[model samples]
Structures are given as C-alpha cells and as structure tokens.
Target chain A: MTLLQVAAFTSDFPDDMVEDEHDIIQFGGKGVSEAIGAILSGLGYSVGELDYQGERGWEFSAGAEGQQIWLLLSDLGDYLMLQVEDPSFMGLRPKYRQFREHFLSGLTDALNRDGRFHDLLWFAAVGDPFGFPDPAGEGGRRPAPQAWRWS
Target chain B: MASPPLQSRARVVTKSYRPMRGIEVVGPLARPEYESPSDIAAKARSAAAAYVDRHPEHRSKAMMAANIAGAGAGVVRGGYHMAKGLVDAAAFVQRAANPLPDVLLGRKTAGQQTIDLAGAIGDYVIEGRADPSRLGRDAKQAVANAKADLFPSATPVAANTADELARRFSIGMNQGELGANVASLAVGGPLAKAVGKAGEVMALQRFPAARYIAQGYSPEAAAYLAEPYSGMGSHWVPRRTKPPSWFVDSDYNVLKPRGITRGEMYELHARVDPKFSTARLPPRFADRSWRFEKSGLRRHGPLAQVWHGMPGATKAKGGGSLAAFGSGAHQLGEEGYQ
Candidate 1:
C-alpha cells in the first residue's frame, strides 16, 4: 500500500457564507451555496437547484458524470470538506485532471476576490500510515504538514 | 524562473505540472483588474472620512448616530442569532424524533434537523459576539450608502414638492443635509418602505459574492472571528480507507536550512546527508492529494434503507445541531473555525 499524498490550503473565506442555519440562503444571511453553485456551473456541471426534495441537505453536489465528488459543510463548521472518490476511474483521468486545475484556480481566485482570504497556504503532505511498531518512530506522531502559500 | 513555493522535509518533491490540455476549453483564468478584498474594504472608510471632513457638523451627527446604530444592530443581531439558535434546536429535535409528517406536516428533513441543532447552540454561542464592535468597513459602507441613497433624489424638483409654496417664490425649505434625510423619511417613507421591503430579499439574494468582492468581508471576523474565507470548497479529500495502487515509495534530496545565522541576517544551508521519500504516486494523479481511494464507498455485501424514508435520515436529524460545528478545525489556523 502506498502513502497518502495530501495537499491542503488555507484562506480566510467567511463563515457568513455558510447557510447551515436555514434550508435556503436567507435574505441578508451569509451563505456560500450560491457561490459554490456558480463554480460548479462554470465547470460545465449543471449544478442542482434546491427544492423540498431528498437532495436538500446537500449544500452542493456535482455528479454531472458518474464521478463521486461531493462538497459539503461538515457537522463541524471548520473546513469545507471535499469528499472525493478516486477521479481516475470515476471519470476519464486526463479530463479529470483538467477539471481539477480549472476548478481550483477559479475557486481560489474567486474566493480571494473577496480580499479577506490571503496568505493562501498549500500543504503537500507525505506520510506513511503503516510502519512496524517502534518507539522512536515519527509514524506514531501526527503528520507535521509543511505548507507554503501562493502569493 | 521561480519554482512554485515548495516545502517538504521528505526528499524528491516532484515538480508541479498541469495537463497539456483540459476537458473544458476554458483554461485557468484570472479576473481582469481584480482588486484584493482589503483594497475594496478601504474604499468606504476613505470616502466616509472625506465626506465627514467636508462637513464637520454632519461628522458629529453621523458619528453619534453611527455609534447608536452600530450598537443597536449588534445587540439585535446577537439576540436574533441566540433566539434563532434555540428555536432551531427545538425544531431539530422535534423533527428528528418523528419525521413522518414532513410532507405537509410538523416534520423537518433530517439535515434540517441537524442544522437547527447546531444553529441553536451556535446562536447562543454567537450571541455575545454578534454586534459589530467598531467594525470599520460596514460602518463606512453604511454612511456612503446612506448618502448615495438620499442624495440623488433630493433635487430641486424634490424641494419644490416638499416646499411647493416656498418654491413658487424661488425660496425653498432647504434644511441642509439633515433636510434630505427628513424628506426621505416623511415623503418617501410609506411608499419607499413598501418598495424597499418588497425588494429586500431579491436585492440581498443577488450579488453577495460580487458585493463582497466589490466592497469587503462582514465584521463577523472582527467581533468573534467567525469566519475563514478560504476558497477550498473544491479540494479533494481521501475518502477511501486505503491508498491507491500506484502510490510508490521513492527517494530524492531533502533541503534543510542550517539554523545558525550570522549578524548579517543570512542563514547557512545544509542538506540531508542522504535523501528519503515517503512515497511516490504518478504525477498526473498528484492532485488527488489526500485519498482513501474508492477506487468508491459501496457496501455490496448488501444494505437497505429500511425506514424513515431515507437511510441516514435519522442520523442526519440526530446529528443536526453542534454535534460538530465545522468539519476541518484540525487545520493549523483559524481557517477551519467556522
């Protein structure tokens, strides 16, 4: 089994943009559903609209193809969690790779447009989950991620 | 050329790359002439200061009025969040326990139940923090927008309408800047109220991002730091319990900086005597960064959604409020502390 290669970035996207309070983004209320919907729409995925339906709980879901990628505000309001199935087989790879670049660049650009989120840090994490038991091993410790931001 | 900023103790950090092409014709693009958020936020305060500078009497009046308005809005919003939280909690529990009547009944969706649960606690949690304690941006916007709202309409025609007889003699009731606000109050009051009320929702629902981009962030960060505007909504997380097959252990040189520094503010460099790599995955799939690759999560062993209309409906409802507020708080900064 190979190690999990994780890259994560941090910015100052506002919490008001989350509409966890209401089923719909309320008037004068901060919620990012609409903003997220706009991004998915830009990516050629016809983002779903909200109604009194089974899919309501999902803040945003872009399953345009059979790809299993979902963006949701977790029960914890901390990080906007992206739950992704392996895109290689979920959709065509080269194309999936394209989806990633346009999506990330567009997203970070759009969010950064608000101007509050800065010092955009990306963490390229490399850590092994499996290692023989040993006392002085770094494996027992949480992966101390190294991050650098794009200016 | 500068390399994209790289930081890794593990050796052989593969260089970053993009596909020769993309699925969509539109490649990565930047907004033309984009102004950063901080820049947009500064505009309002500067404009307000200029306006106040020009009119000292109005400055005193505006400042005094602003303090009252700011404190009032804070207290009101604070209370609203608290009361709303409690109400949401009750609704969450009520619907979560019995969801059968959701279709035209007392029922709420399972997710709704969870939301209300968190909202209730969140409301109380955020109450003490709601007021915009000296939030400069919003306050400046208020003044600028207020002037913008009242000025254009306060023309000679408006003066005529307000003081028609006085206007007939070419002398009108112009009571300085205060008069415009008063005129808007007495004349535009009922009709404007109706129109403003009708348009409030439509106006608010539109242009949030544009407005934020054009102007700035909410004071939620100032009073309580209730936000982290990170544009990470589309990031990939490892969903599979296992890594993909291609992940391979590899090696490369690790760069280390010698801690000892001379007074010239320069640090000596050192390299890891031997290089090491945690593992290597194909570069094309690097963006998949974090993964418990599904290769997908399906229990083909067989499972069924027995009752309550949806399978995880009950859990969604049960977990509604504050079981966990925001997901990625384990992150290094307040970025995850929604």
Candidate 2:
C-alpha cells in the first residue's frame, strides 16, 4: 500500500493568517477548510465532509471516463495535509501515482491563480514504507518532482 | 696541723664551707618551699623566649603551615560556595521556565531547596571558622542574600480564583503527560521484552509442581509422570511437557507471540498512558514551532495506527481508538493514578 501527504504552511501564503491549535487556518475572515472546499469544488471535484479514521476533514472524489480518483484533506495547525488513497480493490499502483501527480499539479496551479497564496514553501511524497525525501527549501512557485521524490 | 684542722672543721661554727670529694660546699642558703607567682611567670617567659630564639626556623615553619592550611580551607570553602551558587542559579532558571507542581503546592522544588540549604549550612560553618564574633550576623546575611538571588519571584502567586489554579494544574499535567508518553515510547520495545522474559524466568523458577503446570503438564497417573517411559515395544517416549507460559504457544522455540508480540504491550501502555510513550519529534523539530508547521504530516487507517499514534491527535480531533486511549491515559497520568 502507498500513502501520500502534502503539507503547506499557511503563514507562507501572502495572506496574513495563522492556524490555531485546532488546525483551523484563519485568513481573510474565512477558514482554510472552507477555502479548500471551494477550491476543490471549483476544480470540478465532488467535495464533501469526510470523517476518515475518526479524523475530520474533507474528501474529494472524481472520475473521468474510466479513471477514478479519491483525495482526503486534513488540517494540521500551521499546515494542511492532503492524503490520496486508492479506494478500488484493483491492485493498480500506477493509477494512484498518476492521480497524485495530476492532483498536485492542479492544486499548485489553483493556488497560483488564487493570488492570495504567494508560494509553496515545501513539498514531500513517499511511495513505500519509510520512503520520505527531505522537504526543506525556500519559497518558490512550484517544487520540482525531484524535490519531493524519494530516492 | 691536720688534727687541729679536722677539730676546727668538726666544730663547724667557725667554718663557712665544707670540703668533700674534691668539691667545696658553701654555707647553707635559704630555700623557699615554692617560688612566687611573679617569679615563676618571669622564668617561664624567659625560657619560652630562649626556646623560640633557638628554634626560629621551627616557629616560622609552623606559622607557614598554619597559613597554608587556612588558605587551602578558604579556597575549598569558596569553591563550595561557587558551585552551590551555580547549581542553585541553574535550578532557579529551570523552575522559572517550567514551574513545577511543587511550587504551586507551596513547597520548594526538589533538589533545589536542598542545595540551597546545604549552601547556607556551609556559609554558617565558614563564618564560624573565620570569625566567631560575627558568626550569626554574617551567616544570616549570606543566607538571606543567596535566598533572595535564587528564589527571587518564586513566591507562589496566590491563585485568587480556582479557575486559575486549575488552568495551571492542567498545563503542568499536560507537560508531564507528554514527557511520560515520550519516555514510554522511547523504551517500550526493550522494556516489554524484558518484562516478558522476566515473567518467563520467574515461571520457570517456580516449584516443580507449579513448573509442571506452567509447562502444560497434565495430571495423570503418578507412575506415568516419570521423565522416560517404555512405550509399546522397546521405544522409550520422552515426557510430553509443553512450553512455558512465556512462550507464544506450545512451541518452545518461538518466544514472541504470533498475534501480539511483547512490544505491543508497551504500545498498549502508551495508548493507555501516552505520558509513558516517548514517540515525539526530534529535539530540533520539537524546539521550533515552525518545524511542526512545515512538517506536519501523518499516515492514516488501521495500518497507520499499528505503526504509531500521532502525538497530538485526540478523539476531539477525530483520531481513532488509539487517540481515545491516549486521551484517557493522559487524563489518568495527569490525575496521578497512572
């Protein structure tokens, strides 16, 4: 099984905001959860409230013809984590990989167009167990695949 | 003429001296039974002065030795003072940064107050040795000054409201719980194995009757309980003894459990009391709040729960059963029951 986690600090965004201990990001008098929901909805994904493993967050599901995708988002104080998992029992690894790549690229593009988000400071991914690359870097437009790929 | 001299000597009244054995004795002198106090004192003074004059080097050596010993003692006393002061200073800073329960309980924190007391006692001894006249005054002043320096602002802020005290108590409780959790997690694997091994060894060391029970020996005829038995023809059968309870199953080779290993007990303990768990970020990550922000990511699902529970996740935050266990254990640890 593969697990993916993507986190970005709210403080790094151009919007002067802070996340409380409850992982609720407050910016422009609107919660980051609401913003994420809006963003996911605008991207043509079906977004809904998710309670996965007793963790409160948002779930995004979408499909185009044959390919289906699922994404889970949870708020961590000062950061947001998006977890992608394969719901189908079909042992297809490449499908999850492709979905992660497309989702990350689309999310990055959306954030860029939002104007409020200044940059993505860090990005990280893990394919297998203990597969984690270093996620340290300065603010930038979008992180290279090499930056988040585990060696 | 000799006879006339002897007669005259025998007369004695006219002679003032006597000759005997080549020595001449003068007339009898007046002898006092005891010397006067003044005379004795004078004689003693003169004798002492003469002795000192004769052994000037000895006097100087004694004086130098006394001075050196005194200086060495002073240096040792000073070193003690400095060391105690530094320790007390460090304790003071630690107590200030993280006020312990003892402070709120209206008691001095452990180790710190004892050190301060020792320092005070040392000061008293030093003062007494250096100057007995100023002993009380000097010792009291030094102690007061040291106390002031070390315990400045240590007075428990009287919590006017119960809510305030409760809040402080909660904060301290949470910190302690976190620390306990971190410690437990750090040593859980080894500790669990050790405990399991110890239990097995204890079971093995029991009396033969109990040991037999632990080895899964069933009660049958006393004759059949022997170590070796001639079964069927000439084939001897060994005792059908089962593995000890410490074994995962009847198989003596496999010590670890197939379903739940010994380490799982420790994980359970951590879940029961996260204070006993030591799972935490490294010091570098923990020290900086920003690092938590930048690196806040975790796994999910039942497999993730088996791997490790997230540190700060709880039931309120929608964590699973592990989180609930953590929360309950944290409360127990905080309440001093765990």
Candidate 3:
C-alpha cells in the first residue's frame, strides 16, 4: 500500500484581518467567516473547530465525507493559516485530484462570489499522514510554480 | 593401680579461646555476598524484589520521591520561563477579561509592553521617529472592550472620555459609559485613523507597490508592480494590515508588530537574488506550502518541519534579527534596486 497523502498550504491574512472578531466590510469581516462556511458546505463537509486541548487560541477543524476532505484553521492568532487533513492516497490518482479540488477550488469560487478575499495565494505540496516517507522527496517541491491553479 | 592415679592428675590441661571478629557491614542496595552458588547477581535481584514485596510502601514512596525530585530540579533549571509563561497567561486572560485592575495597578500587559518597546527601537530605525500608534497604545479604549465580554454587569461603568489626556494616558478615565465609548470609538473612529496619516503617507510614497498588495492584486497579474496611489486613502488601509513579502511566515517580530513564520534557512537563501542582500535572514523563507503550527512555525510537511521552538534567548535572537531585516528590506526597496 502507498502512503496516504494530504494537500497542505499556507494563506496570509493582512494585519487588519488577523485578529478581527467583529466588524463587517472591515477587518475580520463577516465575509471571511461566510467564505469558510461556504467552502465547507460546497464541499459537503461538516463544520468543525479544533479543540486545542491544553493549548492557547482557537484552532477550528472539520474532516468529513469519510475523510475525503479536511481542513484546520490555524491556531496562531497572529497569522491566519490553513491546513487540509491527510486523506488516504492509496486510491487512484483521479480520487486524489478530486480531494484537492474540493477545497482550493471551492474556496476560490466562494471568494469570487463574495469578492472579499483576493489573491488567496494557495501553493502546492503533499505529505503522508502517519509519518510515511515519500519516494520523490525534495524533487517534489519544484520552483516552477508559485501558486496553485484551479478550475 | 598407684601408677594409674598419677597419670589421671597429669591429664588436666588448659586451652586459650578468642571471639569471632565481626565482618564490616555495607549500605543497602550496595555490594552483597551470597552462598557458594554462582548466580549471585540473579540471586541479589531476587532478594531485592523480595525486599520490595515485603515493603510495598517503600517502592511507591521511593518512586514519589524520585518524581518530585525530578520536577523540582526542572523547575529550578527552567522555572523562570515557566513562571513567565504562567504570568503572561494570567495577564493575557485578565487583560482580556477585565483590564481595569491591571491598568489601575499601573501594570502594562505583555503585548502592550512589546508594542512600546518596538516603538522605542523604531525611533532609531523607522525614519528616526516611530509611528505614534506603534509607540503608545491607548489604554482606556482597550480596557472598555472587556465590559460586556467578561463582566457584562459592569456596563454602567464603561464610558468614553473625549478629553485628549485620558485618551493619550489611558489612565483614570476608568469611569466611562460602555455604549457611549463603543459608539464614540466608531463614529469618532476617524480620530484614531487621522493621527498617523502623515507618517503613513510617507511610508506609502516610499513604496506604492503597497497599494497593489492592499487591493489584493495578484503578483501573477501583469499589473502587480506597485502603482502610485491615485486611489483615495479613505478606505485603503496600508502597512498596518499586511506585511511586505520578505517576512518569514513564522518569525513574528515584536518591533514590526507582525507574526511568526518558516524554512530550511539554506533553502531560502538560495532563492533570494544575490545582489539584493539582507542580514539575519533565515537560510530559507517559508513558501506558501508550509502550514502546520504548534507553539512555533511548523510546516508539518514530509520535510518542512523546521520551526524555532525554544523561546528565550533564541526567540530574542529572532526578534533582534528580524528587526534588522525590517530595516534592510526598506533599504533595498527605497535606495534603488537592481
């Protein structure tokens, strides 16, 4: 069996948006929250929040559809970043592409509709869950692409 | 018969005697001696096990003692950091929950102190004068946010004092209206926005590319190069909102008021234009793909797990280095570039 792979990337939130809890059309706009919600709904994944256990700050997460899609809202309050969960990549390549599309493209479509988040620079990289080593290694992260393109 | 009686008298003889010497005793669980059997090591282990069986309480007591001793030593060695983390946590909650007590006590929270220190340093770095917003955080308005958050009953006490002195000092205006203060901060929000325009205007002029970033321009788009701000400043908030590109995603500098971030330092150094130089750069800057985070910057990728986790001297070193990089980035952009 091959290593289970997951799509992972970092997104930046400008300073005004980083710590915002309230204010619409302003920093921490309602649009940002709605965009995330929309992405979950469109992808057919349930809404979730990270427990953080003994740690500080809020880190929300949701991985549903039998692990077809998953996401973790960054815990660090200073910067807003996102992590998609590890889905088993032992399946066919088309299945892998479908999982990747659900979030990145789903998010892009949502942002286009709301027109709030812009240039949401998503990048490419894959990792194995359960710490399985990858065969390709450093050669996998090539410099040719800066951001991920979606349909 | 006569000869036999003489012989019996001569038969009595005396014998000298000495007591056996005591063997020197050794300490418990130390060297031991056993019978002629060869497996003394195994026998000794069994004997030790038997002793514990007889004194089960001693085993537990010994374990408790060892654990306590280890914890005490840990506290002694790393206690200062532990103590600070605890204090910061308390202040963090208290300041968030109800800052009045902290302010009345004349104590500034860690974040505020960090902001002030950054401003003090900026005096030497940011065009000779630190931005006032960065230098002095107004204490009163900040304190007012907690009224409904922690103790909603204190709503009557929260108010807005329009006087400049209270706004500047964030002191003594502890007696204000919550609704009014929130309102004033909003409609009069222009007041907060108005103070730093000149310095910010200078910053914007120094780099118009900021406008593109502000508008969420795609670097992939042909027009990504920064343009002069023909657009009005009314809605476009700059510099304060987003950071420039050179910043590592995980290494937040208190001086710059940005967050922490990534990279294999050697990997990042390879990407930078050799002619465009800066000091104290992490060998690599975190590309967008690096994502997972714990206490520090983490990629959690198959390979991108380089985060500077230790916080004391190492984090301080990061803060100082990042501060220098802030200046270096400004220099590279402003004084002409290749």
Candidate 4:
C-alpha cells in the first residue's frame, strides 16, 4: 500500500461550559488536538488543514498510508489516534475506549520511531496545565509551535 | 685344506683393504612433499568448529558463521556500527533510568540560588530598602517557584535573613506575585475569566523552567514547580491567591521595575541581539594597541581608532627608516675601491 503524508490540525480548546472528561470536542479541550497533530506528523503525515471555529475547530485527513496512524493536534495534551484512524480521520463521535487506548499506543509508537515523535510540545498559559494564560483575557492560549520528528 | 685357508685369508685381507680406501656413507636429506588445497580448507573448518565446540552456549558461533557466510554474499560490512548502536542503545536506556546525582545536585543548587536571588529582590521591592520583611508571601513563593523551576522534584524553602535578602536586592526585582500565587489570584470570579489569567502565569513561568531545562535540568524538575501553580478554579485555595492581572498589573507595574520585557526574556534564551553588542567591544581591540593603552581608553581603543583617527599626528614617509633611525650603525669598509 502507498504511504501518503497527511495531518490533522486544530486550535480548539474545550469551552468553559463543557465539563465532561470524555467529550472529544475537535478543537475543544486542552492539548488533545495539538498532540494528535504532533503524533500524526511524527508518523510521517503532513498535517495540512487546520481551521478554527471560535470554541470549536476541525481537521482534514491525518496520518500516513500503510501505517497504523491518525494524528490529531488539539488543545487536549497531544492526542494521537493511532493503529487505527477511522474515528479520528472521519472526525467521529465519543471515543470512550478507542481514544484512551490509541492515545497510549500511538504516543509510545511515535516515541519508538526513528526520532522522538513524543517530543512534540504542549504550551499552557501559567494558570493552564503546561502553559501560561492569556494576559489580555481573550481566553485563548498562545501558540508556540516547536517542531519535532518521530522516533 | 691348509692351502684353501691361506687363500681365503689373503682374499679377505684384499677385500677389507679395498673397502677402507673408497666407502662413503649417505644421510637422509630429501625434502618432504607439499599438502593439497582440500587439506587447508579442512584445517580451517576444523579450527572454526573447534572454537565453537569450546563455547557451546555462545552466539558468537552463529555470528562467526554469519560473518563468514557474508564474505561471499555481496553485502557491505556494517558489523562495527551495528555493535556500536547496540552499545549506545543499552547505554541510553541505562542513563535515562539512572541520572547522575552530581548533575542533579548542581542543578538544584543553581535553582536554589535563582530562588534566593529572586526572593531578595522581591523583598526589596515590596518593603523598601530597609524593611527586611518586604519579601512577602508572594516573594517567598516566587523563590520557592523559581527553586521548583530549577529542581523539579523538590520545593524551595526560603532562609529568611538580612544577608540572604541583601544579595537578591543586587540582582534586581520586578514587583508582583509569582506564578505560584495563581491559586490565590483566582477569585470567585466567573470560571472563564479565572482560567485565562491562570494560563498566562503558567506560560510566563515556563520561560525560566524552559531555560533551566535547556541548561541540562530535567523536565521532571520543571514540572514539579509547575504543579503548584497549575490548579484550576475548584483545585485552588484562597490563601495562595493574589490580585488579578488588572489590579496587579496596575499596582506593581511589571514593565517599569523588572526589566523583564518579553523581548528581553526571549533574548535571554536566544542569547543574541543589539543589547549584546556591548560584549563585542573587547575582542575588537587587536594587538596593534598596547594593553596599557587599551586599558587607559577602557578597552575602547579599536572602536576609537576606527571611529576617530589615532591620538596624535602620524610620522611621514621614510622620515626615519630603521636603517638610519635610532640605531648605532654597523660600519663596514666599502669593497676596496670597487
């Protein structure tokens, strides 16, 4: 099978109202989208389309062909839809089990590649998890894109 | 019978005499024959097999067989690199698990120093030059946070004293609470507003931790400090809180005092820019100028020479060539009336 370079990118974070931990809101949440993007890119997919929709966003195809991969870079701490990309690629709903499993495996697999795909960064504003908060009260995190190769 | 005996004796004596004059003995001196090609090949195989037999459980036998087999297989040799890679992988894994204690110690000390310095400065800012107690909870927390940033696993505690606080005054201080004060800063305000400010402080604090990490500190150390400041609304308590960005920003004025502009902080990491131009002046003074002269001009000689001409008027052409200038001339008779 042909391996195609693909990626999924978004800047959405969970709305302040969304309290459910299981919700896979595309761009909503913490570093999930960004993490997914990083994981996919690491797996040899070029994350191409990432558009923002205020509190929500979407990404096009992610991950490479002939490889178990789907990278979704959201604000939810670097999620990797790996070993299977059906839900992530199609932007499906509620990944209760698949999300958690894929996240761990994809993260490990990316880390185990030729380069450290796990080296992808997550930035939170100071009050945020790993970054600083918006000083202007825009309710958005600053995007500091640091690139990494897959391991 | 008597005549036959005499003739026999005479014949025996004649035969004995002939042998004594001409007899020569030969020794075995002929060269040995050479062996066949099959014999040499069989010897090599035997040697190899014997070596393997001696080490029955070792994989070296297989490796040897593989190496020998490879000779005619047309693959380029990579045994050395492969072996080195194996060694490196083993070493990397080992190192990842067991970090050097000495390195960790140094990192911790540096982090502590940073906290101490930041606290002292913060103290001076809050309580005037004399009131030693001015480095308040926020300042105390800043030191702790800075220390946390430096040493990820442990919290930095302050040793409050006149001398320790004095040193930080020298380093300079920017007024305001540290990233650690975020929990206290977040009030009963709407969740949307609280989260934003919280994230900002976290980002600002990440810089120094990032700096430390870049300087060989572990991410674990940075994370330890970041943990206290990362609490969300429900997670945080009131005692650790400080004023919001609006009140704090206006009250302390972070820009005027700290000298910690984003640009400056970024430059501190990149270690470049026009501000660093001051460092370039020293090397510019080359050997042409005397050390004393350079020192006299405060080592601004090169710049001075380049920008403005030399201190005094220069000598004119051939005004005093070494041949005729200030030297006791060596006299010689002209070649006898050339």
Query: Fnat for model 2?
Result: 0.00
State how far residue B53 of model 2 sits from its true place (Å): 63
TM-score for all models, in order of appearance: 0.22, 0.28, 0.23, 0.14
**Tens-place lDDT digits, model 2, residues B139-165:** 677665434322313234323322222
Off by over 4 Å in 4: A1-46, A49-93, A96-105, A116-126, A129-151, B1-338
Query: iRMS for all predictions?
Result: 19.4, 20.1, 18.4, 26.8
Return the TM-scores of chain A for each candidate in numbered order. Answer: 0.45, 0.52, 0.47, 0.28
Query: Candidate 4 residues A47-101, lDDT tens each?
Result: 6454332111233344343222233222322222111223324333334244434
Root-mean-square deviation of Cα positions for candidate 3 versus the true structure, in angstroms? 34.4
DockQ of each: 0.02, 0.01, 0.02, 0.01
Cand. 4 TM to true fold: 0.14
lDDT score, residue B128, model 2?
83
Query: Taking the tens digit of each residue's C-alpha lDDT, what string does model 4 give over B194-298?
Result: 433443344344332322222222333322222322111110111112446553324122212133432222222112111011100011122110111111111
The lDDT, on a scale of 0 to 1, for candidate 4 is: 0.29
Candidate 1 — which residues are off by over 4 angstroms? A1-30, A40-45, A49-59, A63-69, A75-88, A116-151, B1-338
Q: How many backbone clashes does candidate 2 have?
A: 13
If chain B of candidate 2 is superposed on the true chain B, what is its TM-score? 0.17
Cα lDDT, model 3, residue B259: 20
